[model samples]
Target: MDFSENFLHYVWRFRSFDSAELKTAASENLKIIHQGFLNANAGPDFSNAKIQLDGTIWVGNVEIHIKSSDWLKHHHQIDDAYNSVVLHVVYENDVPIKRKDGTTLPVLELKNRISTELITRYERLFLTLTDFPCINQIREVDQLVVDAVLSRTLVERFEQKTGAVIEMLNNLNGNWDETFYRFLARNFGFKVNAFPFEAFAKAVPQQIYAKHKDNPLLIEALVFGASGFLNDEFTEAYPKQLKAEFQFLQKKYNIKPIDATMWKFMRMRPQNFPTLRLAQFAALIIKANHLFSKIMAITDVSKLRMLFEGLPVNDYWKTHYHFKKQAAAVSIQFGKTSINNVLLNTVALFLFAYGKHTATQSYINSAIKLLETLPAEQNAIIERFTGAGVKIDNAFGSQGVLQLKKQYCDEKKCLSCGVGVKILRSSSNHH
Candidate 1:
């Protein structure tokens, strides 16, 4: 009766009104001329439902409602959708309903006819925990349908990403530059460690860059800005070396440094903490002064990856972004896949966040390229779960599966899921 409650699935599987030989409780023989797409809301909710009572043929649509009173509750009396409605199908038929001309609507009570197995399955799906709500159904449905389902999941995945982007836009107030930077920082940490990275970004005041624009001082600032090393008391030589450099920059650019705890390195792999992230960020900034400008017009994945090839970190970055007890050489690299992932995240964030403002899907191609090249058990698992169709596409596509697994299938909320509606109805009548 509540057509909004996985109603489309029920209609598709049950063929609820398809058998014209059937009759409603009123003894009117039923004949369905058309049943619109499962999710149809526009035009007519339910298409032709021709029936005959006492040998007089009637031809019109069937209007579905959760409760008989919902007819009046939805203002359907004045609604044109109700105008073509010849019969009201409801789970409960306590109240009477009428059309504009005051002919009482014939009622079809479906509660008893509805499969208990389907209802029970839904109840159980919501009650239990599982990896996939209808994952079990995967082997049964046609491969093509499953493929289509994943494709729909893909768009749905992007839809969610777009929603998040909209939220970010509201927070950033449409400033693309600041939005990209903040989003980048947040994304660098990934979902597991995003807040920590954000705190690191907020702590590294940009004044460090303003104060030491000269190459050496700038490099030192970049390193110290992230190391959690800047907060320590400086010796005479420390101030002398840095201050001596600062004096030269002072004439050209007013230099003042703010103290922030150098990023924590204890117990962390030297490459995994704020020190490395800042170096990466700085290398990126130094290599591309107007980085985003170069690619604002680019949506193609392959071309985007090409654009990023071998852009160097600042020269000083070769020797140090962090001066640990022992120093090393300049051979560090961000995995191609890693960079691709980052770009995919940014691209997806922009595309989805921009909403109707941007329509091109080159970002999708770009993501696909990045994901296709990445190596990981998790990535492989996702690619496998989605099946070997187009392969892992991007941060949006990869994270989308994680989102679904976390949000829907994990909780077994099948009654609320599209696939659940299809499967539960069969399982209800299943012996």
Candidate 2:
């Protein structure tokens, strides 16, 4: 008799019940023609259910509860949304309920009809200690079911990413190029410096950089200066020259730089330093004129990777990770992993947003296709799933797994997850 409303939701969703002996509290035969859609937002538990009571067919919302007394507990008796509820389903029909119109409502109790095995399985799934309730049983789920879930989660992830992009687009006044520039700059910083990089990009608008885009050094100076990196004293000629150039540009453009302390360097690899990332971003800007247009035209993943790979930091950056610091001389080109991250996070999301904004299917398809071609991201969450025997072949699966973790597993919304439903319905023999 003790279970979550979500468990009841799952039962009603899949009709996991003995249909032959279904009857109301008053013993009237109840027939379920349709279970209806589960509503996540509000109003009803299930919408548009088709049910037959006695000899009359009813079509309306269906509300569920653990006990029929919950009808007054939730105050649905006074709320008008419950007025259309044709049938009330519950585990225990302890009391009679009425509609907002003061008419008696029929109730079907599930306590006698639901399998004991299903209840035991539900309790096990919902009361587990693992990060994912189904971690032990996920491997037992059908690969086809997993695939279907992953495919749906992938679309969910895309929609979530596209939603963020749309917000950025609105903030940028519907300028796709500006939105793309900000997103690209954020990815260039990766996780370590994304915040400062985003702040720096906003401080120095893309239009300002587009003016000096013809010259890579000027672009580098502008980016570094607006990032507040130029404010520090440097013993090297390269940084000193950059500082001098930025001073002139800053005054000419009336630019205000972000706080240098905002950029993080402690405990970060030299290759991922903000200075190095900014230089690479500058180089990318120099090479990729009308970047948004170029990205939209390219459909091949290899060519997309090639575009990022071709970016090379200035000669000064070849020997230096920072202004005063020097490291072994190596070409400061963006690594494959970094490029993949950019493509996955920035380029793909941008493509999706562009597709949605313009109603272009090709761009949306290109976004999905690009993720399919890329390798699966190596991260703690993906590794966790991998250790649990979940197969993730590419970024498509990786994105889906991320969505599943954040939206379903982490939130403990197991009843709404496909894998969770499968595990709960498989059997009650779980150890």
Candidate 3:
């Protein structure tokens, strides 16, 4: 079986291997100490494991399975990999698994041996009956313990971001700023509207960013690129003028204009469509042309806010980006809530990325601080992530959210997550 991390932990906790005794088949007195399930790869599937057997303190790999028979069913034998079987654990022990050399491998079956509370915790968490795991029990883990686990989870969070970063890198031509913008745009949709904004960014290429460097027209190009209005042969004067401009720009840059669907306006106010968001994004960029450099330089949260304060968009855009009713033309203005939400999230991720060198604590603190700076989140992404804005909970909550979101929640990797591992291990250790 191409067993993922889930069954591995289940096996370890249940100890399907000869739980009858704490010794391997080789007369080694086996002792299980630390149990980890995050960093394991080829040999044993746990991160940092401490197991002693035969009075010899040995540490290498510890593999877990649903049944002892899985050792061969998963082809662990004859693979030369089973040779490192310091301990074989399983949830259920039916038949004894023999290595290729014909020696009974050590097995621990945990059905009757482990604690009841640990198992209950696991069930409560992975089964998803509530908002969070250990809601009542979470408080039991003192502040120090919570901090330790959160820190570990944060590291897990970083490891998780590495994949997205890699994928994002593939999208951009190795330009960090381009990748940042694209991600920022996608994040605006908060997954529900992600593809729409991504379509927006692609339709308005980096080449265009150059063309409109000093002018907001490039911003307009990006903002309106995914609105689908450009695809129509409208007799409307502004539409016709934009089309004419697009034709010239298209020829100049060899870029194709994207005709992606607008993010839904159904049930949404007119201000929520592709038009307004694009305008706001345009204004933010125009206002803060040196945004990336500023973000990298600043460690203080207030400093970050100062960088973005200059971008309220010129009067012409504040009310018009989203709607235009002839004589009552509205200029588009990016509300403080939307801009700060994006900036804070960006800063959090940036600090998370660069935490090794600088005071990661400041990054964490800044994330918390910026929530107050932002207007209670009116946007969908922030609302979903932070539970309706102006979050009072500290970065500890943020760390949990980072993992709970990025790993368990977003990708459904709960089975392989540290939280999931915690469930199984905690179950095995239950009272």
**lDDT tens readout by residue for model 2, 37-150:** 898778989999999999899999999999999999999998888999998999888999988787889998888778888887777776776668778778999888887899
Cα error, residue 10 of model 3, in Å, equals 7.9
lDDT rank order: 2, 3, 1
Error of 1 at 266 (Å): 5.9
What is candidate 1's lDDT per residue for 30-89, written digit by digit as tens? Answer: 654444333356634566556565566677776776677878887888876667776677
Q: What is the TM-score of each candidate against the true structure?
A: 0.67, 0.93, 0.65
| Candidate 1 Cα misplacement greater than 4 A, ranges | 1-9, 12-20, 36-85, 90-104, 111-128, 166-174, 191-193, 196-229, 233-267, 297-300, 306-324, 327-331, 351-356, 361-397, 410-431
lDDT score for candidate 1 against the true structure: 0.55
Model 1 residue 234 distance off true place after TM-score fit, in angstroms: 5.1
RMSD of 2: 2.6
Say which candidate scores most in TM-score. Answer: 2
Whole-model alpha-carbon lDDT for candidate 2: 0.86
> What residue runs in model 3 are displaced by over 4 Å at the alpha carbon?
1-39, 42-79, 84-99, 103-136, 188-193, 216-251, 260-263, 310-331, 344-347, 350-396, 405-431
In angstroms, give how far residue 168 of model 1 lies from its true place.
Answer: 4.4
